[model samples]
Target: MIVTASSITFITPQVATARAFYERYFDTWSPFDCGWYVLVRLGKEPDAPEIGFMEPRDGAEPFRAGGMLNLTVDDVDHMHARMSSAGETIVIPLADNPWGHRGFGVIDPAGVVVYCHKAIPASDAFAPFIQKGPDVPRGA
Candidate 1:
């Protein structure tokens, strides 16, 4: 079976700014704005969560302990502009990669990492995740 109803958590030092970064850049993304936790929907359907923000931790438990999330965008530059305006720290600038993608990075509340990026040629930047093994064929 396929995976459904999953949330990738990002630990952050600042929650409000992290929340703002997503609200400005993403397209049609609705996030559950709880006081401590926030869940951002990245899909067209009613129950598609692209990313999420957990409660803040005392230390870098999530990032140092190994946790991060990614959400591909249509325009990385546009996102950079908005996020910069929102004063979200730019962990990395939008640029082309040797692996074939134009992307950038941002740190969010609860110590979570929110990556906003787009493909250089606007193609399958998420090919690694979308691709399945023998159990799930490419065309199936």
Candidate 2:
């Protein structure tokens, strides 16, 4: 099957709070508010991945904890500094990972861990495990 677009919907009782958190931190994204649900698009492009926030319904439960959202950025340091200056909670400090990334984590209002990172050269231990797919772009 051919996939046209991609998105992840998070169930939360505090939809407005979640929406405000994302809007404040992730400025590049544009949010489409729909009262009970909000869809935040990464870009103006139609195929851009959307991060959605929706209210729990019909006995559905909200996400309790341990949810992670990985966001790839051009500059991890700048992003970290910006969030830090904004008084956002930083659960993980900026550090280089052996798996070829420099990143930090921030917990949102809904208890979701948002990891903002940038790609870097992998260490010897993880280099061999890094494989490039046919359609995947190089230097990613």
Candidate 3:
């Protein structure tokens, strides 16, 4: 199947606040404003994934804490500093993990988990999660 574009939509009571949080923390801007719905993008890049926020409609359940949004970046350390300076809640500090990543996590205003990571040399513990071939998967 061919995929065109993709986004993760969040339903929140604080639509404007959530939108602003993403804009400030993720360095994104809203391109589409539909009153109750806002679409945020990283920049002018065509392939950049859009992060959307929407106000809950009637009969809609309130937002809850679930799932995670993982974004890979070039420098997790720089991102950590920038995010901290911006007052974003850093749930996890940047550090090298055994899974071959230097990463950190921040909790969004809507209570969604967001992680930023960069690749690094795998430690010995990474062997279980690494796949050797198409037919063989690790950590099953």
What tens-digit string does per-residue lDDT give for candidate 3 at 70-99?
888888999899988988889988899988
Best by TM-score: 2
Q: Write the per-residue lDDT of candidate 1 for residues 9-90, one digit (tens) a residue.
A: 6666555666765665664455467766677776668866666666656654544534556777777888788888878777
Any runs in candidate 2 off by more than 4 Å, and if so which?
Answer: 28-31, 134-140
Model 3 stretches astray by more than 4 angstroms: 131-140
Q: Model 2: which residue pairs collide? A: none
By lDDT, is 2 or 3 better?
2
Residue 53 of model 3, lDDT score = 80
Q: Write the per-residue lDDT of candidate 2 for residues 19-114, one digit (tens) a residue.
A: 788777665365578788888876567776688888998988998876789999778899899889989899999999999999999988777899
- Model 1's number of clashes is 10
> Which of the two, 1 or 3, has more lDDT?
3
| Ranking of all candidate structures by their TM-score, best first | 2, 3, 1
Give per-model TM-scores: 0.61, 0.87, 0.82
> Which is the winner by TM-score between candidate 1 and candidate 2?
2
Taken over the whole model, the C-alpha lDDT of each candidate is 0.65, 0.83, 0.82
Q: Which candidate achieves the best lDDT against the true structure? A: 2
